[model samples]
Target: MNLFTDIRTLVIASLDAMVADGALPDGLDFANVAVEPPRDAAHGDMATNAAMVLAKPAKQKPRDIAEKLAEKLAMDDRITSAEVAGPGFLNLRLAPGIWQDVIGSVLAAGTDFGRSDVGQGKKVNVEYVSANPTGPLHVGHTRGAVFGDALASLLDFAGFNVTREYYINDGGAQVDVLARSVYLRYLEAHGQEVAFEDGTYPGDYLIAVGEDLKTRVGDAYVGQPESVWLEKIRDYATEAMMDLIRADLASLGVVMDKFYSEKSLYGTGRIEAALDSLESKGLIYEGVLEPPKGKKPEDWEPREQTLFKSTEHGDDVDRPVKKSDGAWTYFAPDIAYHYDKVTRGYDLLIDIFGADHGGYVKRMKAAVSALSDGTVPLDIKLTQLVKLFKNGEPFKMSKRAGTFVTLRDVVDQVGPDVTRFVMLTRKNDAPLDFDFDKVLEQSKDNPVFYVQYANARVCSALRKATEVGLDVSDAATAAADLSLITDPAQLSVAKKLAEWPRLIEIAARTNEPHRVAFYLYELASDLHGLYHLGKDNADLRFIDEGNSAATQAKMALARAVSVVISAGLGILGVTPVEEMR
Candidate 1:
C-alpha cells in the first residue's frame, strides 16, 4: 500500500531490465539508489538517483544510463513519464490513477495505513524520565516523559517490542534529604513548629505526605532519633513521591511498563556481578585517574581507585567504579542497571535524558558496550529545556513545586492532548518555547490546533454526508470510484497521504518522533488547502449536491485524511478531536 515503495520497486526492476538488455552493466549495487520526492515539485512527483549512483560502476555516462532507464520505466502502467533531469537524476510523474488509489488504500488500511515492520519485532527498551523520586515531576522531566512515551509508541507502531521504563533514583543521597525534609513535615503535623533548612525540600506538596504519615503511625516515632526514623521515613517518602509522580504522568497519558528501582541493584550482588563481567574482559583495573583538565596540581588529589577502561569502548577517559573511600561511585549503579538490561536480552536500548546530562552519554554508552560485549546498541537522546511564557512574559514558578513548574501545572492549564502535541512541535535537542497564549490559539500558527481542526473538519463533512443519506462508512467510501477524484487539489492531498508510510520508516529509523508531528502538520495543511478550494468550485466540494457517486468519491478522500491524522496523533499519544471547541 506504500506508493513510494511500490514505485521504488518498479524503478529497481527497470534497472534490472536495463542490465539484461545490455543498456547497463551488471553487478551495479543498487543499495545507494534512492527514489524520493524531488527537491522542486515543479520538476516531477518523484526523483531517483539510480543513474547517478550507478554511472561510475557501470562504466557508462549518467545521462546515457538515465535515457535508457527512462525508456524502460515508461513501459510500466504506473509511471506516466520518466524524464532525465540535470546530468543523471530521473524525475518521475506517476499516473493520476495511482494517486487516486492512494486514497482508497488509506481507507482500506484505516489507522494501520502507515504502520511499518522495519523494526522486525526486535525487543527495545526505552528508559526515560528517570527523575529522582523525591518530588512530583517538573517541566524538564515533562519533556523527557512526553518524548520517551511517544518514542515508545512510535517504535511499537513500527513493529518493535517496546518496553517503557523508568529508572528510579531512589538509592541516592537525595532520598535521604527527602526523608529529613519529610521528618520536619511530620513534626509540623504533630503540632510542632519546624523550619525547612536550605538543604531540605520546602514544597507545600509534602504537607499532605507529612499529614498522611501521622495518620499511619499515630504518636509512633515521635521525637525519635535519626537512627530510629531515617530508614523507615526514607522508604515511606520515596513511595509517596513516586505515587505523586505517577499521578502527574497519568495526567499527560504517560504510563511506564516498568519502574526499576536503583536500590534493587545494591545488596543484591548485581553491581559486583556487572563489574565481574567487565573484569573478565580485562576492562576493570586499579589505577589513578589523571587530574581533571583544568585542575591545578596543588588542588588535585591522586588515589588508587577501581576503574573501568571506558576509553577502550569509546569513552573520553577511564571511569571509576569505586571511590577512594571504597564505596561505589555514582556511576556504579548505572552500570549495573544497564548490565541488567543487557542481560534481559533486549536487542536495542534507548535512553531519554535531560539536556544537562549530555556529558553522561559517552560513559553510559561505553558501559553498555562493554557489558554487552558490543552486542546491544544504545541510543541516547537528550531533551532540551522548555521555556514557558504567559501574557507575553516569562511564566512564574509553581508554588506547589517550590522551584519550578510541575507537569501537572502545564497539563491542567491545557488538557493532555494540547500539552503533548505542543511539547513535540520542536526537535528534542532544540530548545522549545511553550507559549500558553499561542498554543491554545485556534489559528494556523498553532500546530496542534491546525492538525486537530483538520480532523474535525473531516468529521463535519462525514456528518453532513450522513445527514443527506449518503453512505459514508469505511467500506462504502473505500469502494467508491476513486478515479472521479481527479481534481488537482484532491490529488495533492492523496500525494501527501502516500508519504505517510515512507515518513514513518524514516522517523523510526532515526528514532525521532518529532518528525511525526511535523509530518502531521504538513498533511493537515494539504487537507486544509483542499477544503478551501471547495468553497468556490462546487465540483471540488466533499459532498456534491444530488450526486451520490461524486460525493462518495470526494468524501472518501476526506475520510482518508482523518485516518492518517488519527494514526499520527496516536503515535504521539494525543487523542484526535472529533470536534474542536
Candidate 2:
C-alpha cells in the first residue's frame, strides 16, 4: 500500500471536516496539499503542506490552520503525532503498528510489491536508438539503449501500455555510401583489388556481408557497374547492418516491439496523407526558405519549394518539406512518421534521441501538435555522451582497427546487469563516465554490486533460517505474525519498504528512470545497514534459536526487503542475484 497517498487522503478528509465545522471556509482550494517524506528524517516520518497552501486562500495564517488540522489528524489511529513546524508545515509520525504491517504487506506482494496503477493503462509509444545503419552501435548509443529500455520498463510497471520502437533510417545519402562500400567489398569477394573510398565505410564488420552475398549468388554480377548491382546490394547490406544492430541491442537486453523503416514511407501514401492533414489546416505552403542565419551555404539562392508553416506552432521559421529538385527532404519523412503514429491512436509519444538532435526536438513536437490538433503529446528525451574511462584516462575507440567498444564489449566484460545499472547511474542529459576498473569492484562504491549484495544477503538470511528449522518460505512469511517486529532498526526498513509504491508513481510521472536507480541504491543501503546491525545484536538476527514466533517475524522483514529489491531490479531489467560471487 502507498502510505504517502493514504496519508494525503486523510489530510484531505480532515480539511473537508474543517470546512464542515466552519473551522475553515467552504470552497477553499486544497489542490496543492501534498503528503511526502520530510526533508529531514529526524523531523518525522511524513510531512504535509496542506496548512501552508490553504492559509492564504482561507484568509487565515498558516499556523492557525496547522493547529486545527493537527488536532483533527491526531484522531486517526495511524497517525500518532502531527506537530507544526516552521510556517505551519505539519510533520507526522506514524503509529508503530502501521510500519509493522508494511513488512507483512511486502511479503504478501512479493516481487509485485511496488507495482503502481498510476498510468491507468494509457498507450505510450517509446521510440529510441534509431542509430544509422552505417555501422555497429558504439558506446554512445549504448547509453540511450539502456536508458530507453529501462524507461519503457518503468512505465510498464506503473501501468502504461508501452511499445518499444526503432526507426531504421534507410532513406538517406548514408545508405548510398553504405551501398558503395558494400560494392567495393563485393568486388573484393570476387578477388578484385579495391580500395574503400574516403566517404565509404571501412569497418571490417561488413566484410562478412560481402562474403555472404557471394555465397548467395555465386559470381552473378562480379564485374557489373553500379546500375545493375547498386539497388540489390543496398537492400542486402541494410538488412545485414540491421541484423548486427539487433544483435547489439540483444546483448544489452533491449528488444524492440517494432522496427519502422524510412524506405517504406517513400512508396506509401503516408507522406502525402500527413502533409494533406497539415494542408487542410493551412500549415502547408509553397515558399522559399531563407538560408540559416549566421551560416549560409554556397548554393544560397532563393528557390521555390514546398514548405510547412512550422513557425505558427513554435518553430523559429517555416521548414522546407521538399527540396528544389522535388524530392522529399529529411524533415518530410519525420513528419510523416509522427503522423502515422498519431493515426495509430497512441495517447502519447516519447522519442529518445542523442543530445546532438536537440535542435530537432521543437520541430518534431510541432509536427505532432499540428497533426493531432494538440490531442497527442510528444516527449523527447535526449541522452548525452558517455565517456569511457580506464585508470583515469579517456578510452579510445576505432572501428577500423577492430578495437571499438560495441554494446557486446561492455556487456561481455561486466554482463548485462552491470552494464544496464551503471549506464543509468546518472541523468540522461548529463555526461556519464563508465569506468571499466571501478564498476566491477565489490564495494559500496560500486552501486550495482552493492544493490546485488543486498539481495544476496536476504537470500543468505533465508538459507540460514531454513537451516535452523525456521519456516521462512513465501507462504510462511506471508502468514507470519509481524507484530513481533518492533525494533527501531527493523521498523526503519519497513518504513523504506512502504515508500516503494510511491516511488514508482513519481518516477513514472517524471519519466526519470534514474530515480529508480537512486531508490534502489537507498533501499539497498538500508537493507545492508540492518543486516550489519544483526552482527552485534543477537535479537536483531533473522533466526532465533529457540523461538519460532520471533524467527518468523524477522524472516518476514528480510523477505520483504528482497521483495522490494526484486521489484526495483525488474523495472531496471536486471535480475536480482541469489548469491554474490
* Top lDDT prediction, candidate number: 1
Q: What is the per-residue lDDT of model 1 for residues 73-179, given as tens digits with 9 covering 90 to 100?
A: 99988889999989989999999998998888888888999888989999999999999998999989999999999999999999999999999999999999999
Q: Clashes per prediction?
A: 0, 0
> What TM-score, over all chains together, does every model reach?
0.98, 0.97
RMSD of each: 1.2, 1.6
Give the lDDT of residue 336 in candidate 2: 95
Write the residue-wise lDDT of candidate 2 on 230-262 in tens digits. 888889899999999999999888999999999
RMSD versus native structure for model 1: 1.2
Query: How does candidate 1 score on lDDT?
Result: 0.93
The true-versus-predicted C-alpha distance at residue 95 of model 1, in Å, is 0.7
Model 1 residue 544 CA deviation (Å) reads 1.2
